[model samples]
Target chain A: MNAVADITQSRITRRFAKLKAEKRPGFVAFVTANDPNPETFREIFHGLPQAGADVIEVGMPFSDPMADGPSIQASSQRSLKFNTSLKDVLAAVRDFRKLDQDTPIVLMGYYNPIYVMGPAKFAEQAAAAGADGVIVVDLPPEEAEELDVHLRANRLHFIFLTAPTSSDERLPAIIARASGFLYYVAVAGITGTKSAEEFAVKDAVARLRRHTSLPIAVGFGIRTPDAARTIAHHCEAAVVGSAIVDVIAQGLNQEGQPAPGLSQKVLGFAKSLADAVHAAQH
Target chain B: MSKVEPRNSFRQGVDENGHFGLFGGRYVAETLMPLILELDKAYEAAKADPKFQAELTDLHKHYAGRPSPLYFAARLTAHHGGAKIYLKREELNHTGSHKINNVLGQIMLALRMGKPRVIAETGAGQHGVATATACARFGLKCIVYMGAKDIERQKPNVFRMRLLGAEVRSVDKGTGTLKDAMNEAMRDWVANVDDTYYCIGTAAGPHPYPTMVRDFQKIIGEETRVQILEAEGRLPDTIVAAVGGGSNAIGIFHPFLDDASVKIYGVEAAGRGMNSTAHAASISGGSPGVLHGNRTYLLQDENGQITDAHSISAGLDYPGIGPEHAWLHQQGRVTYVPITDDEALASFHLCSKLEGILPALECAHALAYVDKIAPTLPKDHIIVLNLSGRGDKDVFTVAEAMGEKL
Candidate 1:
């Protein structure tokens, strides 16, 4: 596919290129949009870039997140209480774009919300709102054509997930339609549930690298800075989702309101992870 | 509109990509896709294997009590005073429900695939009990995920599953219903893909599952077809069954789909009413969306967030319907109607009083619809309703609904 050429000049492509030049692995921070509250989430979104997030994955909350573990599921529930819509998520990206044009933002969630909004409209709106890519946890390669076509036409990257269970015979089919990067799900389970062994992730990344030139980002279990540092040593980027979401969950008061300095506290955790990832060397 | 050429067969469906028109495709995470595809291949092989067929047939006859009598409900037929009603006695099957038919097939397939542990999700606990029983028979480990609220109301079935040597895990997330139980089950399958076979209760999940479950459960319709023809010398004028995830309904509906002369009706639970938000009527009240690994009619909000579904019957209280039901509904081959809680309760009592048989609340919804249309048809007209399960597990709920302490 011409997907690689299509996204050559995109924000995601540029960020990874810069990371390769610096000889440092990138750090991707994930947080549910409007989590805790819209205003607090906005502050966290704006602060992510300065806190050293090479790429940002803004979670679009849905009612049923089948692939998610307790942490991300709770995060989505908290975000939904504020009525976080896809439009609101896009608007967050748009606002973030005004302050920092270089940081790449990818919206991650299930397919039902995007399917409800209409695929073509979602792609157009996402591109227009300055989002660079999408990672639909439930939309595997087999069922991705409808949304992928629209994303390709909009010049936005459609990131596909490769799991530990994704066999070598299946890698070709998965990577054939992939763009931006391949997200190597470190664990065979749902998000935030189990940590991946560094050796296993290293081997899996090596196997994936032999097939494509796309940058690989490992996710699903890297929670602490040490784990992030070790995982980042193998892939182009290390992604931490539930870990940061857990920080936000912990920062919430008993009344379900964000305590004072919750945004700062979440950003602080992201900074520590980013520092560890950026410090990774070959 | 121009005259459309009628298709040769309505039974042919679900293209290789696991779609029924715009519905029913593999919409699971990448983690489960390879395993689901593997399952599809195993199922196809088993379908063509004479040994597998013989074994399933043997189990159905000797183990689960096959050919559950197609009882002629003479008293109810006279009470309706119009259509001669027949009840396909699936309730007489082992475990007191139609769930065993599909469980027997799937658990046998799990053995073939060498997956020793089996996991399942249930709202009414009928499917759990069936799976647990199968696991006990086969000596495979069994884990059943049940919603906390469902476990509370369905205490007897929960106890039955435990007695059958299954571990029951309570899921308290997302309104603590079937939807939540399904989510937990998927998580378990994802985490334990190597040895665990996810025995989905209904025909609603991803491909191979919808088709596989229907294939196993189609004995209901196959038997009904033969029994009705022998008794009435013709196919019934109409066939009615309740749809939750639509396993039982699809089982009976698939065999008669090609018969143009026969009419079909699928009932959905309208908890309070269709006008009110409380209901499990996906086709009648909701629209098409993807959930639980397949694209089907779902009770979702404008933002595509799934809404909680309500029904007096735990078995019928799910937010989505099987993709095949969505296809059949869209094709206009099967008419889907909503039956309210009060209507179902009345029928539940009426059928018991008239036929000396207590039908499941899920089946009562179908009887409620039959109660509406049967009286309007001629006495010579025949209508067959699937008695999908026995109501023994529902006595406490029914008594409470009747405001009785017992």
Candidate 2:
């Protein structure tokens, strides 16, 4: 991955083409803030881009993320216990930005933290820190006009979700305002599973096609190569998150000592996912 | 689809299409993706494993008192002036509420996972007392986080938990209510994730929690189906229950989810009135959003921030409803209605005088709805009401509400 791309060009379009040409689907890895510890993030943030991650979604920890499952809940709790504030997360991203600027980064999570911090200020700090997009999970497209406007004004794409259950009537509005790419939730449930019926993926992608030409990225439950392959055949991109979190959790400090090869483990896993996407070539 | 049992609504949670009508789907964070998948796998295995189901059944029968009585309330029916009334007496369960059913299920899973410590939060003290009771029975170290205000008002339950050898932590931040207590409990669990199991009180958390809790509590409806068959020789015309985080109601309502002939009424605490700012009617006044681990309807502000709620009953003061309840409401199978504080208080005294049952303030909300709807129906109509808990915990609050002190 290049450290710097042409600033004047639409980098998202450029990155999409390069991945498609290489017969490799784009990967967006999502991880909670301050998992294990904040300091450990230095390696995770920098290593992901080098390991072929097209995008990184950093979770902004919230006290009550109702949409999050136990693993993420635990991660958020750990992060919050270490006092991983919005400011702290921003600083980590800014520092990571200095190391590499090509890979687009999106902060994904709940809306309470951003609301408490003030949306305008959050967008400002996020944009200034070199975040390419923001996906507030709880902030639905209908309720996110102001936040979307602020982020767009700062040249940051506002990512939105189009679920299998989302009505055809609501798709156009969601697709019209959405940037970066539309996150088409392949299954009707939480993330982590590698197996969901293939028909569900195809149905959602088919429905989304009738609405917009924007790239449709299937996420939630797409964990392995087979699942990614099935999803990539129907959508433009495939997201793998829980499988990576599990790997990172395994690489955690073992036997009361910090794992020495933490960065190596994450990069190895990312490379495996990238390889999986590439191996699924038509 | 017609079943051998002849059910009413659609069974959409079966993953054929991944929905319960337009309500149930996986809307969650990426970090917990693997854990949820694991939980789904575990649940699937547990469901098919007779050993797992038998163990849960044994615990329920011996510990939580399975098949809690279904009594005919002839006097309450007469007082209502028309419809026949039956009470599913879950209050007689191990911890004096319907919460024990789900706690037992979760505690068994916690043990299976080799988790050593059990943690939970409570507002009315029913779930806390029940969780503590389960931990005591299982010989697990239990820690319960309760809001400071709840602790003060629910001293007897706090003492009961302590007597059961569980540590009770009081949370004093963020309105010092159920939501804050939940936040603190989640934080503690996260801090001790390696050894501790966060036994959530209600079927309102993320993914498997809501699904798992519902399954455990479904025994209510399962038993009620047989009990009603024997009692009235037919299905009741209506089923009424209170909706505090909506666990008990959902437990009783799930087996009947597809039973179209049975009209299910979930009573939410209106605090003062539906229009008042003090109400806890998330279904009546709130919109769908994500909070407390599920994408369900919640009483939130314009900015989508969860709002603090109020009710005379501590358990019914939550601003969010169970996701399944949201699904039921959207599917139009269950009618979500609000009963004001005055109505609940009046029902409490009336039920005490008429039936000699001092109903819990939370249950009183359901009773109030029964009082409202029963009189309007035909005299031969049957309405099964879930008396969720005993009113012993509400003595002090009831006294204050009635302008009488112990």
- For model 2, residues A75-156, the per-residue Cα lDDT tens digits are 6666766777888888888998898877778888786567557779899999899787788876655446757777766777
Model 2 ranges off by over 4 Å: A1-131, A135-282, B1-9, B14-33
Q: lDDT values of the candidates?
A: 0.94, 0.77
For model 1, the superposed segments whose C-alpha errors exceed 4 Å read A1-6, B1-5
* Candidate of highest DockQ: 1
Best by lDDT: 1
lDDT of 2 at B22: 37
Going through the candidates in order, what is the number of backbone clashes in each?
A: 0, 10
Q: What is the lDDT, from 0 to 100, of the residue A207 in candidate 2?
A: 77
lDDT of 1 by residue, A144-238 (tens): 99999999899999899999999999999999988899999999999998988999999999999989999999999999999999999999999
Per-candidate interface DockQ score: 0.89, 0.07
Give i-RMS (Å) per prediction. 0.6, 9.2
